[model samples]
Target: MSQALEQVVAELRNSLGTIGEIVGISESATPRFELFHAPNSICSQKVRAVLAHHNIPYRSHQLNIFEGQTYLPANVRLRLMGCIALGGGLVTEHTGSTSVSMGGCDPAVVPTLVDWETGQVLVDSKRICFYIDQTAADGAALRPAHLQNAIDAEVAFVDNMPNYQMLAGKPPGEDHRPESRRKGNGVGFAMSKVERCDHYLAQFADDADLVRGYSAKRSKELNAAQQLFTPEAMRAAYDKAEAGCNHLENKLKSGDDWVVGDNVTMADLYWGVELLRMKNMAVESFWANGAKPAVAAFVDKVESIPAIRASVIEWPGAMY
Candidate 1:
């Protein structure tokens, strides 16, 4: 971490004991990285599941995204630094919950990973998970070379779905999430994201990096605001996720237990979280429910995996 960023993380952690705690014990003399994540974020869940599945160790700092902890100036600065490192620019569009899913760097969000010794700040859950998977010694690769192409396809498939947007806005006729869990209970923050970013934008107007970061985030929210909860937009989001599940159902009908190959791979890891997210939202009506026994069974099997279970199913912020 940069000297300035180091102080910021230190300050954030100092008060984290109340709202955040580390998830795993460090396995090496030197820690690999520190994760700034949120317990309920689908993206964060994917990363946590990867760490658990591979038995990798990390310092986990949980953020409450709804409360805009991720929009804090320090966090914004860190995310923007990550954006620049990846050659990404200001956000002018938002088709997905996070920019990473839409082929851009995220200047605002949780689950940012910062390396310990190198200070390499990694954003995007898929990149972070693949980083941990590929860098491990023998017998630890999640997307092994021979399976890289296939695994990547599966991962990208999940990334293509509007996972976050599906929850952000619910179609009254189609949404099945429990009443208390709908709209405001857990996923309404996007409605106020622009205003929230503005609050911090004022605090760091002079800090060039902070100004750019806040502005990028505000732009992201502004772009998404236009269609956040319109009935058409909400239904479209649901259809997208359902169509994704249907595609998986067709793949599984071939009698394979996993998305690709015979054994569990990174593909399974990504789909497990995706399925879990839909399940929690009660949004599995047509594709993964009783009518689609194959897909339903697959969802059950993946969620039961010990590692995935701990990482997401029992996460503190998980909705029923």
Candidate 2:
């Protein structure tokens, strides 16, 4: 980690319990890992599912991303550092999911992991999930040696689903999310992000990186603020998500219990979150209308796992 990242982590650790709501397996002394996450985020759910699945012990530093928790000064710095470390001064554009995929990184997001024992700060849900799996207790991992390639492809397929953008803006002339969720977080995140960006732009006027970071976030938010009426953009995202549904349906038609096989792997964990997010988005028409029976059953099966239930389904306001 860079000196800046280490310093930010140090500052964040000082305000842990006060600013963040703690959950997960609490250890008396310092836990081996500390997670900074938001329950509303799909990425956070993915990492939480991995940890819960393997029964790994860690401290959960929960944030309210919709309330601008991720846009707070310290979090902005932490996420900014992670982005810069990934070889970017700041996030200049959006292509796919903010925290995953081959498109680009979102400078402001949640579910950052601090591996205290190893002095490592992990970013990105996909990377974090794999890291947790490989370093699992007794070195036990989810992916079988021979199935590694297949499982990785499945994971990547889930990563490509535009869950973030879907929530940021829904389909034009039609909202598929359940009525209960229509009044949820994603609708106002752009506004929250704007407030934080403006505040930091004035407060961190002298810090070039911080200023640029906040400014970049503000620019993205401004674009998203107008995205609500943009049929083209929303339709494009919907098409992508629709494709994901079709892909999963095809994969599950082979009579597999999980994404890759009967046993759960990193792929299964990721798809669990992705599938649930899709369902909650109320986009199930693609697979729920007696068309993709296998996909529907697989979604229920994935959620049936103890870890997924406790980590995702039970998480209050976890998905928008």
Off by over 4 Å in 2: 1-7, 13-28, 99-101, 180-192, 223-229
Q: Residue by residue across 193-260, what tens digits does model 2's lDDT show?
A: 77878988999999987787788887767666555425687778888887888888888777766778
Model 1 accuracy (lDDT, Cα):
0.75
How far residue 154's Cα lies from its native spot in candidate 1, in Å, is 1.2
* Candidate lDDT (C-alpha), each: 0.75, 0.74
Tell me which residue pairs clash in candidate 2: none
lDDT of 1 at 216: 73
Q: 183, model 2: CA deviation in Å?
A: 6.4
lDDT of 1 by residue, 1-320 (tens): 47876876776676454424456776664467788998888888888888887776777788877677887666776787677776656566677655375746667787888887688888878888898786666486778788789889889888878765666666558457777556452234564888887887787778888777777777767767775556677778777777888888888897776888778888998988888888877767855437778888888799788778888887777554
Worst 10 residues of 1 by lDDT: 182-191
Error of 1 at 38 (Å): 0.5
How much is the lDDT of residue 238 in candidate 2?
83
Clashing pairs in 1: none
Angstrom error at residue 129, model 2: 1.1
